[model samples]
Target: MTNPAISICRVLLPALLLSACGANSVVISGSFPTPNIGKLPIDLAVVYDDNLLDFMYTEYSETGQEEYYIQSGQSHIQLFNAVLPAMFDNVTFVDNLEAAADSGADAIFVPNIEEFQLALPAKTRLDVYEVWIKYNMRLLTAEGAYLADWELTSYGKTPTETFLTTESAINDAAVVALRDLASTFALSFARVPEISDWLANR
Candidate 1:
């Protein structure tokens, strides 16, 4: 089916929509399939901060006729659950970074959402909905010593013609970003100097 050709101000659809000219509350259900990579021989602990678990991005157009919201916090956990286990022998989750020091883990990983941006076709004058996610990664030893810290970005876009509604296109774009994040993390983990050293010493 083809996307409906309608003005952003007239695209009032979906349960999370607002009565204003237009509003979109796109709920991104994650889809991070397990990677077909070998696991590292280490037990790991991951920390999910409250912000990451409840991440929501909201914005309004300058004209006050459009608003957008992306709910991705819950999906972030699902993304990690799917990828971390494939990258480590044993994976455990902790509420806080400090708690991991005593959790009998070899290392701790903390992923924080640095920024999330969305661009609708109306805003960018483009034919696609775009999503960009920036993440800050903190790596620590079991004893809470710093191993490494780095930033990574993931991007995704869905053609406007592909989805029948704005929220659907936005949702697909966000999913693509999450998938990119998972794949990039798994492939880049062993290449960081500090992390490689930690793995070597272990």
Candidate 2:
């Protein structure tokens, strides 16, 4: 005699897998607003390390179930590199505040990311992949004091929820996270005066 539950699981599993691999990826788009008036700086440097990633990864891990780890930090760095140019027109790097001050950077946009997530429904038929990023950056002066701390989150959705031979859902999740980071930061910067000043100077 065939077990009904077993039969149901067999049918649902494949269907879920199929649907899971083809979820729609959602993304937000935006840019920073022009400051009405302020002292804008130029030339700033970014210093990031394991401490920042550790904080972010911890938060990102909180949103999902099952044990997982970052296969590579390269993606996160690449994403930041991609978005930084667009965020600051005059951005530059220096060894420290002393160098930055000498270089005449009016301000800084120091950012620390807190979270990047890839999510899916638990025990579901489809692969429903989701990507998320949460981070905080401080805009500081050559004095080593902060002008403001900007907290940002970026999220993405996949086109579908299924995985054939390839893992489209996971890929979408990462891409979405990267794209949204730029968009989210752009919007947040536009809304914050200090950020505008910092970016203008950078």
Measured against the true structure, the TM-scores of the candidates, in listed sequence, are 0.86, 0.60
Give lDDT for model 2: 0.57
lDDT leader: 1
Could you give candidate 2's per-residue lDDT for residues 1-202 as a string of tens digits? 9999999999999999976654333222223323223322345555545554334232122334423433325455555555555555566655455666666665655566665665555433455666677777777776768788867787776656334212445555666666666666655665687756655665
What is candidate 1's CA lDDT for residue 80?
92
Candidate 2 has a TM-score of: 0.60
RMSD of candidate 1 to true structure, Å: 8.3
lDDT of 1: 0.86
Q: Scored by CA lDDT, what does every candidate get?
A: 0.86, 0.57
Which digits, one per residue and each the tens of the lDDT, describe model 1 over residues 107-184?
A: 899998999998889879999889999999998888888889999899999887842698788888999999999999
Off by over 4 Å in 1: 1-22, 64-66
C-alpha lDDT of residue 34 in model 2: 35
